[model samples]
Target: MSDLAITLLAGGVGGAKAAEGLAASVYADSTHIIGNIADDDEFHGLWVSPDIDTLIYSLGDQIDRQQGWGRKNESHQVLNELEKLGQETWMTLGDLDLATHIFRTELRKQGVRPSHIVHRLAKRHGITMPILLPTDDVIQTRVKTNLGALSFQEYFVRERCQPTVNAVEYEGASIAKATSESLSQIEKSDVILLAPSNPIVSIGAILAVPGIKDAIEKSNAYVIAVSPLIGGKTIKGPADKMLTSMGKTNDSKGVYECYAGLLNGFVIDDQDSMDATWLETQGVDVLVTPTLMSSTAEKAQLLSKVIEFALAHRNVRAA
Candidate 1:
């Protein structure tokens, strides 16, 4: 088990949930989490890497359980001050959470690599398992909507995902180079899992980085994706609507199509067992289980099943 490396591509609350599960599992020491940074944006002159910070907060057991992101027992005095100064005051960066942004911004200003900052923050939070970024380059998610092209945070947070999405783009991804640590992890991993994050923005943004998808395609690891949709709808985010708006199906099959050629297996909820059965017949492994991570026990249970499924069919492609 010490030599068995597990790598996870993750972002958002769903990704954080997956990270928490893997971090608490027996493979915690061997697991590497690669988070999405496309949702990163600047507020009050400070850089905020939402996905990465969420992972750190969640793993450190400091996440606001009710809101699912931000630090627990947080205060908004900073935001209140900004509001008094006529700032937009929409992003809602809590006082405690603002410390992370300030540290990250200062590090970025001093020319530290974004990937290194992620791990440093994770370590400082008492999180041992490595939390990494896919690239050191600045790649952002841009959604073309009725309100024009808005940044990932603008669409998801500022607008509350209400505007109709015309298209989604990973800005700067066309030439953004993948970090060596990400590729190295994929190469050394025995199992690679894509968290049940948004297919279009979260996981999609990570894959959009040059060489990341290629590395996964060429890796010897057993790669799998956990669907974010259940019964053709998302539990939290707008993945279902976004998929449909992007002219893709919103069901389990639609979610699988997003990863088309890169997956050996997929995990869907029990409600989509019929879809799973059909997928299994198409030379792809499928796992059917309860994917809603409503509790810590449930999250681990889902991941444990995924690990068992991967082990039973490890390196099947090479065979």
Candidate 2:
């Protein structure tokens, strides 16, 4: 029954877990998620928004918990057929999951905005919380490696993120405008959370959009981020490897540095307590907790601590 309206910036499995936690909390109705669209791409003439759909499926409780993406009980018949036809099926879209992409592509063809499509998709999945896109424009993540620049999907899925990371870029972010809904949500929120997604590709791409970072910087809300790294490594994805490859520390302290000026506080795993004192020296409040959201109860527990931490900062900011 709290009055706080939370707007979360998120992407990938970690992001979904954070969103799941908040969706199960008392502030569920007041939570709005702004998801990354930079990881989006086309597969077989159908627009595939991986990060956005991950949020939708996860929040809808239809996600494949084992794979951490796509739908539960999904069939890959379509992908199998495509492979049989000599199509490069590295992306691996299940039959049921392809339906979402087809629907989204059709809507886009008919001139529907991406945000509106996401709203409809969420509603169809019985998700009550809002899922917002950072922009309606095409902003994609491009990874530059020694092998050459690859699309985020190519680097992530095709090569299995094995490329030696040289640089990461959001292709259209320099000119892309932030969606009105996303900016307004940030302004209206009492608390803003940066989910424990891949900072370089997921959260980084969101911030790369022209006005989103400015909106966060100017917001009066308490901004907090959860570190995806636990003891200098990620449970999923190549975030830790990317961080290290890009000349950044692969720990909670590095996560804080990534969002340095924007955050009022940071949530790290209890095992990373060693870095707490140094983080405090940099003038950011640190909250060390068990950030691994392995179970439903654990997700809720982590979010409960995060909420409490945010409330404390909100009070101080208000005072």
Candidate 3:
């Protein structure tokens, strides 16, 4: 189990939580995370990568557990000052959190690859696990709403996801080149797990990158996704709503449809067992378990089951 090289495709709070579980598991040292980059945006002239930072903070045990993001015991003096200067402050940037953005922005301007910058940041924070970015090239999530198209930050933070989403698009994805490091991780991994993240904006954004989906399709590793929706509703975020708006059922079935051909198996809560037969008919194995991870214990419990499932499949594949 310690020798197993597991790569996770993840984003958002749920993704961070899953990463934390795996990081604390016995396979922690061999685990790698490929986080979404499309949620990135410029804030007050500094590059702010919310999803990536969340992963880092969660892994480092520096995350504000209550809010599930930003630094714990953080002060928002920077945002308060910006607000006083008549700058929009919808996106809260704490003083400590500002340091990360400043450092990342500086390195990015110095022409460092985003993946390299992430490695440096992780190292500085004492995080030993590999954090891979799907692409260094700029790819932003755009939400098309009845009012107008808005950047992911605007739709998620400024507008508070209140606007009716007509559609979603990954700007620059077609032209964006997938990071070699991430592609190699996928190819070399023993197992690939899709974190219980927003299927549309988080995991979907990573897949939208040109070579990423192809790499996953080509990988010999078994791919499994834990459903973010439990009982057709998201514990946090707009995943359920987005899936519904996108003409998909807001349940485990919708999640399976989103991942479709890429998944070898799907993990769903016992409550969503109604979709198990349908999914199995589509040639995807179903694992029914308690998917909620509100506590660290629960997280480890779920991850242990996932690891066991992966190991069983790997042995069969090897045979």
Candidate number of the best TM-score: 2
* TM-score of each prediction: 0.97, 0.98, 0.97
lDDT of 3 by residue, 239-298 (tens): 998888889999998888898889988899999998999999998778999899988888
Alpha-carbon shift of residue 141 in model 2 (angstroms): 0.3
Over 4 Å off, model 1: 315-319
Collision pairs in model 2? none
Order the candidates by lDDT, highest first — what do you get? 2, 3, 1
Q: Give one digit per residue, the lDDT tens place, for model 1 in 49-97.
A: 9888989999999999998899999999989998999989889899999
**Candidate 1, 59: how far from true, in Å?**
0.3
Query: Model 3: what TM-score?
Result: 0.97
User: Relative to the true structure, how large is the alpha-carbon lDDT of every model?
Assistant: 0.90, 0.91, 0.91
As for model 3, its CA RMSD to the true structure in angstroms is 1.1
lDDT pick, better of 1 and 2 = 2
Candidate 2 global TM-score: 0.98
TM-score of 1: 0.97
